[model samples]
Target chain A: MIKAFIALVRRDLLLAFRHRAEWFNPLLFFGMIVTLFPLGVSPEASVLRVMAPGVIWIAVLLAGLFSLDSMFRSDFDDGALEQMVLSPYPLPLLVLAKVLAHWLVSGLPMLLMAPLLALLMTMPQDGIAMLEWTLLVGTPLLSLTGSIGVALTVGLRRGGVLLTLIVLPLYIPVLIFSTNAVSAAVAGLPMGGQLDFLLALLVLALTLAPFATAQALRISLS
Target chain B: MWNAIWVFFHKWASPRYFYRLSGAVIPWLWALTLLLLLGGLYLGLFVAPPDYQQGQSYRIIFVHVPSAWMSLFIYTFMAVLSGIYLIWNIKLADVMVRSSAMLGASFTFLALATGSLWGKPMWGAWWVWDARLTSELILLFLYLGYLALVNAIEDTRTAARAGGVLILVGVVNIPIIHYSVEWWNTLHQGATVTKLDKPSIHVSMLIPLLLMAGAFQLYYFSLVLMRARVELLEREWRSEWVREMMGRGSDG
Candidate 1:
């Protein structure tokens, strides 16, 4: 079982690397959004500083979303997802492995790029570490939860938008908690509370999301 | 008792029998709903004294509160029904889900609209990022998402299955959404004093409030049953029971 899971992850990682555009697209998209916010809101440092935590988090969210809509597409198109569903290994285990790979490709890059985006946005130095840490805890959640949305809609021809409408609401807790943690860290307040909540949400998503995503994948195929 | 309950579930699990049963039951439900709504309205509007704080404006609670309850109730019902459909392949459950989605959306919209109307006089704005209000709005989005997913797919069984999983996922997130909204609201601002003082519910107000809640429940049953019958016919158009139903209607 572990071998199959590892093989799936390794295969997904290889596929993701071969398609380098998938690698660059979300990073560029994240940078563009952070740049746009300064223009759309204000160019002043103080304003950007205050807005930085929220701005960065929202951009990270949208960036993850931009990539999540395609999470299952290639495999779904080439019939890999169907084969995974039929494999002797449980579908949920396969789904968790794919989600881990998705995070490694789509979610982790956003984490690495956050400091640069935060610097570009003129976010305070104190909040940068917290911002990266929150993204670290939160982005895997994005992939896990986002995979559920992708699975449900992958069967549809134009499911991308509907996928956003459905999945965005579910992302609310992660957004609220992570943003709060960053802001709290900047303010030198006790952030353990907010971080704990984010941890709880991540745990919940890790436990429940894979099974739901697996079930949704099977249903979409059927 | 468990045997009796199982027997009841088994009977209704059959879509044809459910269609016939709902047809027979809806009119009676409508009559009961009408009676309850009228009674609740009379008690709420005329009999109950004005609220000490918000005055007569508090009357919207009769509608707003019940609609909110109905929204939650219907969503929960839809999630459970969808789970049954996914697991047991119950066609009756899918029809119930299809019938209930729009009704759930309507109830959610009513709750939001009435909430905003209540907010205007109470909060001095049409909408506040109030915790309850935010959660209700998210619930509305969840309903819209479910409806859109189901309708997007061309195949009925696939639509039901896909929508079913989405619903189950949404249900799991609902409590988390509600709690996050509460904490987020408080984290940003101090709790605002709202006019709806739930604990001090005067006996007079409580009577109508519960009655209205009951009325809304009946209305949901009545509405969903009517819609489910039509859904059954549309889905089962080639089936003999529907043809028999149509022929009986023609003969009558």
Candidate 2:
């Protein structure tokens, strides 16, 4: 099972790298969204400082949304997903492997780029660490939860808009907690509670989402 | 008793039997709904004394509270129906699930609209990012998501089963979402007074609230059953019972 998991993850990662443009799409999109906030909202440091946490998290969210299609779209198109479903190994394990690879390609780039974007937003120095921490915990949750949505819509012809409507609601709590934690840190307040909440939600998404995704994949593919 | 219960469920599972049973039960439900709505409206709007704090505008609670409650109640009801459909693969359960989503979305919309109307007079703003209000809005989105998913899929049974998975996911997340929003609200707002946190209301106000709640429950059942029957007929149109019913000229 472990070997299958690694092999699936490696295969996905290799596929992601070979495409090159698709993996870079989310990072470029994330950068563009973060940059737009200053022009659309304001360039004032004080205003941006207050809005920084929410702005960054929302950008991360939209970027995650942008990349979700790549998680299962290729494999599903080429019939690799059907093969995975019929393999001797459990489907949830394989689904989790795909989600992990997705997070590494899409979610990790956003996490790495967030601090630079934070500085661009004039976010306070003290909050950067907390922002990174929240992303570290929150982004995986996004990937795991989002896989369920992607799997459900994998078979649809025009699933992009419908996918956003379905999955964005599920991401609200993560956005709330992560932004709250960063804002608290910026204000020199204790952010432990919000971080803890994010961690709890991550744990939840980690355990339940893979099975739900596998089930949804079956339903969609059927 | 166990054997009888099992037999009852088995009979109820049949689409034709369910069509007849709901046909018989809906008139009573509609009658009860009418009675309760009239009584509750009279009591809630007129006989109930004015609040010391907000006077006449507080009467909106009669409509607002019940609609909000029904919104949550119907989502939960959908989740349970979805669970049954997923576990037993019962066709009727899936029909009910399909029938319930639109009603749930309407109630959620009603809740948000009424709550906003009430807020404008009371809070001096049409909307506030209060925890209850935000969570209700998110609940509305969840309902819309379910509807969108059901519409997007071409195959009916597959759409329903996929919708079941979405509902189960939403149900599990609702509490956590509510709590996180509440905590976030408090962190920013420093404990504002919650609008509906009535610990000790007088009997006069409480009576109409409960009456309205009962009225909403009956109305929901009546409508859901009516919709369920229509859905059942549409899905089972090729079945012999449906053809016979059509030939019988819509005898309810």
* Model 2: CAPRI class: high
lDDT of each: 0.89, 0.91
Q: Write the per-residue lDDT of candidate 2 for residues A142-200, one digit (tens) a residue.
A: 99999999999999999999999999999999998899899989999998998888898
Residue B146 shift from truth in candidate 2, angstroms: 0.4
**Candidate 1 lDDT, B218-241, residue by residue in tens:** 999999989988888898899887
- Name the runs in model 2 displaced over 4 angstroms: B1-3, B186-199, B250-252
Q: Output the worst ten-in-a-row residue range by lDDT, candidate 2 chain A.
A: A197-206
lDDT of 2 at A197: 82
What TM-score would candidate 2 get against the native?
0.96
On residues B1-252, what C-alpha lDDT tens digit does candidate 2 reach at each position? 999998899898999999999999999999999999999999999899999998999899899889989999999999999999999899999999999999999999999999899888888899998888999999999999999999988889999999999999999999988888887674222322233665366789888988999999999999999999999988999999989988888775
Clashes, model 1 = 0
Model 1 spans > 4 angstroms off:
B1-8, B186-198
- Model 1 chain A poorest ten-residue lDDT run: A117-126
